[model samples]
Target: MEHHIYIIPISTEKLEMTEDNHSMTNEFILIGFTDHPDMKTLLFVVFFGIYLVTMVGNLGLVALIYMERRLQTPMYIFLGNLALMDSCCSSAITPKMLQNFFSEDRRISLYECMAQFYFLCLAETTDCFLLAAMAYDRYVAICRPLQYHTLMSKTLCIQMTTGAYIAGHLHSIVQVGLLLRLTFCRSHQINHFFCDVLPLYRLSCVDPYINELMILILSGFVQIFSVTVVLISYFYILFTIFTMKSKEGRGKGLSTCASHFLSVSIFYGSLLFMYIRPNSFNEDDKDIPVAIFYTLVIPLLNPFIYSLRNKEVINVIKKL
Candidate 1:
């Protein structure tokens, strides 16, 4: 038998690095919509239009809320925060996605990918709790109109908003920290457009058991908690509305709740569909369109949903 020896060269820097450390040189190839190369231009145009509309609509809403004195109520305050978060959430992913459409190099560095993932998570998590807060606000306003001012005071509103932001940061920190521990040795092609949690975890060479569990438990808790609050609030609101003797009062109350319910339904529906399941569901490319709807289309549609249904916003716009 002949003896064979194979010498594999290793860089000195790599040898010194620990298993937990990810190499800066590692790049992820986002194979986003590349299979439909023929539709690249069309997709670009469509997403670009969506991005433009999202920016103008969200920022415009924020500005309108700020400039108009009558719009400075607690409800409008929450609306402004939602607009800001929506703008940030869409911005964190859309610009890079648009660039990927035209660029031959779809490679994203490890740091950039992580940064994108972090901000996206922050905005999303914050929005979850923010929606809950908004629901609670509505509950107080509708169910206990006399006590609404006392229950949702300026101080309480600020505290709730602060808590939402803090919760978002903490959630992202834990998630991103877990993700950084895993090493990626397999192919770098991320099937999705952006650096989503499931796609990144699937690409890891390790078992990713802990990461997946954390996602399931933490994300499920947030989703369930938020949805519970919204449901409970709406239940009380509907009860209170029906008890009212005046038809005009009932119609007005329903009108307000309808817009909020619509917004909440659209947002939470897309989110749950994308994230409520295991990583096995991520393998399907069909999820990409759903992800786009969650991240981009929802943000774009939010302004229209709220503004079209809201006479206050319309009055403000007319005054401008």
Candidate 2:
């Protein structure tokens, strides 16, 4: 027997009703992977495995960093925060997505969707800032090795991490607050796997000009600022490495930056592709694969990238 998923649209008369009545009944049907019913089981198994790896790897990395006193440095601190963010980020989407694979109704309440979007925004934005912070730490360690300890003090590390979380919350609140103001009527069928900002914004019956502007300005600032910091840090690091007399110094510097650079490339590449455009311009069908990479795959890959590249994490794990 074949199972078919259906999304029943709200009637035009109902859409014309008052905001109060609409709010009471507002729900979104997520059109996630329904087009490929044949792959439901396969997708579920694949995503389930990815989700497991993401949870174990990220949470393990966090625990490892916290318990190992020798690994307690500015770099590892930022890495622990990254692992925490990745775990939270994957958790926000993967569980629901895996559930939807077997369930007939893929319906999510409006407020629930908003909550998911808020968390997603928080995690992703926090990650951007945290990566920038990591780059700065690397720069100080390599470029100013003599003064690294004094420059990247324990207090400063905590403050920077705290600042990243605060910035993330502020960005999420503004975006989600603006989202609440928009009226979502007509068709409540969200043409995506999850309740992303762009998909939700597309459902708005009212003009989402303010929301779009806010997304563009805020998201653009975070992305550009983070990338700029990382790039500039690497630029100086490269210069410093070239001027070094020893080949060992150059090799060590490149090895440290390579993993970070690879992770940054994957992250910012997907991020830029997804958000650096108007909502209307985004092709919903095309976005799923890209979204899966950042939201699901990246989390799974981060721990492997950091652990495989850094010997300290490996030694700590072996000791444990």
Candidate 3:
């Protein structure tokens, strides 16, 4: 327990103590993972397993991309970066969250909480932009075969990736910077699992009308613009897939884009659920699962979808 702070407890013992004394609620209590009396250990084990799998899968993807010379193509170049982002994002949130599963004190300082949310949002946004860029690569490859090399040249690939990092950081900073402007005199308890902007704002005593508008506008532009571009590229790719003269050519094209399609679905689907709608549209049962899906499940699934599903990648991994 944190010094001078009475934390919300996980057990009946703590619950009883709280009931007897009523000396809690000074710090944030995360009502996540599970609330069952007997299921605590089981929940911990399950999440610890998922965390291990996520780490190994993302780390393995990064390692393979780095070690394999033949796998250093434009597509795999973006894949490697995405893998790194997934690993970093998961590490930033999940390990601490897993610890919170057992620890009584989940109280985070306003600054520390905002920092956590900032990096998590930054990495997530970076991955989104990177996926969009990779989709554009596939669009060029399938939709313009002859120009694929020139369109997605080594120099162009680096520029796209660098642009993703910059755009993601810029997009993330608006919210984080705005969050820094608020003074937290009212309460310190965050509602959701981590220190997400939405949950934090709900607890703020000050009117976050400006901050809310900024979040919506900035989030809308980056998410909607990126997703729209990717969808448009895939739309053309799909049209070309149906019209391809060679069955092999069509199959190859679909194979190349399939992993990305799955990843985008997993990411954008979860994100839209979490962020696209206003809080009026969100309920606890609905939002909590979506939050966990985006923050936890997607990272574990991204590398597998990208690496094992691609023939060239699988061959590279098998050889390694």
Candidate 4:
């Protein structure tokens, strides 16, 4: 069997060019926070601060969920998983990103870059599912309060979390598998600090029709599926609120989904802006900033959102 490996046509002279030419052409430079050496310290400090906050916030949520049995409902269970996913996703990118910001090398080997992307995509996708799961849990608890326990049982909770991990990782495997079919050309400079699918796609010399289509379809589905879940859950929640004769009941109903509502808006808003629109409309400079909200800021915000909104979480935290 023969496989046609597509490649960019490098001129014979260019391929056999001087060492300097190859070094410049073959090198994959990372676009870190800044190119200036003096900026390294500033970037390191800023990113390091953000990274610390993310870790503390997520780890603390994990702890709160574990120690508080009273908080051991499907909502909190899914929240704990979301916290874990957020922490992992942030860790997957931020530490190396912060390091790259400071280091002189500022170049990741092709394999290393690919590996980073593999996990980054995996964790982020998992967060999407996890958040949706949290929404469903809220829906059951609020809209179907009488049957909440029966609907969101321990077994079902475990399966949803398990399914999310399974789904997210399976999604990633599909992408990495697709990438394996493509070949890397001499171009190695990754545009952003950490490896991302879009940058890698641009760098490939091969026809990426298959990979591009898969991403478009798969990403669209993840967006639509998760958003639909959130919307449907909230719609029922709103209907339940309308039916509630007690003002207290209605307030409680809306409050349960508020954090999730804010989170969904932020995450999906950026995603829709980035992937849902025309190809030529990309705000490339806004990529990192957009990434910051979902990747870094959202993780930091998770624990705060849950704790501030849920008296049980705050009370539990105070107890410890």
Q: For residues 1-320, what per-residue lDDT tens digits would candidate 3 score against the true structure?
A: 66786786599887798774443333445555545647768877887888899989988888888898888889889999998888888877777777777787766655667677878888888988899998899899888989988888999999999998998788778888897776554545555677777776666667888888887788778889889989999999999998989999888878778889989988887887777765723345565677778878888999888877878888887786
Q: What C-alpha lDDT does candidate 3 achieve relative to the native structure?
A: 0.80
Highest lDDT against the true fold, candidate:
2
Q: Write out the backbone clash pairs for model 3.
A: none
**Candidate 4 residue pairs that clash:** 28-188, 28-189, 29-189
Q: Give model 2 RMSD, 1 decimal.
A: 8.6
User: How do the residues 11-54 of candidate 4 rate in per-residue lDDT, one tens digit apiece?
Assistant: 77766676655555434677846646677878778778988988
| C-alpha lDDT of all candidate models, in order | 0.88, 0.90, 0.80, 0.79
Ten-residue segment with the worst summed lDDT in candidate 3? 20-29
Give the winner by TM-score: 1 or 3: 1
Residue 96's lDDT in candidate 2: 88
Model 1 ranges off by over 4 Å = 1-25, 278-282
Which one is best on TM-score? Answer: 2
C-alpha TM-scores of all predictions: 0.91, 0.92, 0.87, 0.88
Report the Cα lDDT for candidate 1.
0.88
Compare candidates 1 and 2 on TM-score and give the better one. Answer: 2
lDDT, candidate 3, at 19: 75
Q: Residue 313's C-alpha lDDT in candidate 2? A: 89
